[model samples]
Target: MKLLTCLKQIPDRDTRYEINAAGTGIKTSDLTFEISECDEYSLEESLKLREEHGGEVAILTLGPQRAEKSIRKGLAMGADRAILVRDDEGKVTTPHAVAKVLAEVLKEEEYDLILTGTQSDDWSYAQTGVLLAELLGLPHATIVMEIRADPAQKKVKALREMESGWFQWVELPMPAVLTIQAGISQIRYASLKGIMQAKKKEIRNVELSDLNVDLSSIPEIEVLKVYFPVVEKKAEILQGSTAEVVEQLVEKLKKEAKVL
Candidate 1:
């Protein structure tokens, strides 16, 4: 009944971002980070499963040193411990590289289930979980909304959501991966007791080289540029009496905005 969850640290949603001078990435110096919102849902689901099945939940995260904050937050949310796959250089890698690293690390770990967010807010690639599953030769389901586990039987029923509110229920064998959707359950705040207990939780750091992964290796895809989206401006002011203003507005819409 042991469960593992993958957490990713992303920029805060409310943070005002600015494109870097090279147009290759955001100016991260002033940015605050938090666990991806969807990852929080996956963590909550993992905690809930552990609560019901009476086992441990361990978190796995890959990022720069600052990502330890997000890992600590997961521990405060009741994950028994955590493993941090560190990238000291803070070089942005592809989802494939990340999946490879996770697969390698997970090979030595013992777990009956693995969960990850449907997608990361920063990249929205939504490729890591399934890729990791493929690399590990494990079956997986994405957009998972619910799970019912039977540790004794070594099987779990997963409810997956499709387009237009449709859902598919699947029973997968033990050691399956699932990409969880957000809002599956309410995220709980860290209790004072849980916070204090988390201070003593183990956070084991594993460097990329220790996993036999090198940052200089080439990836399949290269990001040519990363810049802010172009901002379009549209505004109109109507003058004169109410009726005249209305007429002018309608005329302007028909002639200029083209939404008569």
Candidate 2:
């Protein structure tokens, strides 16, 4: 089985962000980037599959040169190699564009399975994997919490999550895509030796233009502005007997907050 996992580098959740002067995106100069949290789980699951099935695991990431750090992390975690779709212009910003690029790239590669996080931390767009499946004309399942593969049968049984703690088992043929949910497994840390070895792994960089991608087909999803959630503070005191304070709280919930 040849497995491919799509990973993304995103700004660390704790990093302080400032809107750029253009206001179209955040300031990138001093921002810290790391693998999207959920992608780590995807990468780990792909590595585990390779360990059991005896195959090569490769990663695909789309970003600028800075994204190589995250790619190396995947290599240290046991991916055989990586393919980077270099996008210095940041043109591949939307999930639509990402899926288009990945589909085009994967068209030339042969893989038994493709895995990706259910959503990206930065964009929270939970559509890439499914969209890629559509573009590639492959069967797919999303929100996959568990995966069981049968090499002889050339298929995988996926446990998919549903609303209100429900799950369904789906058997998909080989050459499929799955969007993995978080908490699928405990992600392994990179050992010093593995980190050193990762330096020797191959990372192939491909410019977006080299793919012969149709410029007319790429859709544009513009971001008009980027800003953090506004933080507001307010305090109220109900100075009265316990019963009266309770009444005030109820009133506040029903009227002021309207959350009742």
Most accurate candidate by TM-score = 1
**Per-residue lDDT of candidate 1, residues 1-260 (tens digit):** 89999999999888878888887778888889999988999999999999999999999999999999999999999999999999878654789888988888998899999999999988789999999999899999999999999999999999999999899999999889999999899999999898999999999999887776554663667778997668674655677999999999888889988997
- Candidate 1: lDDT of 190? 91
Residue 76 in candidate 2, Cα distance off native in Å? 0.7
- Native-to-model Cα distance after best TM-score fit, residue 11 in candidate 1, in Å: 0.7
RMSD of each: 3.7, 4.6
Lowest summed lDDT window (length 10), candidate 1: 211-220
How many pairs of residues collide in model 2? 0
Error of 2 at 203 (Å): 0.3
lDDT of 2 by residue, 23-43 (tens): 888888888899998789999
RMSD of 1: 3.7
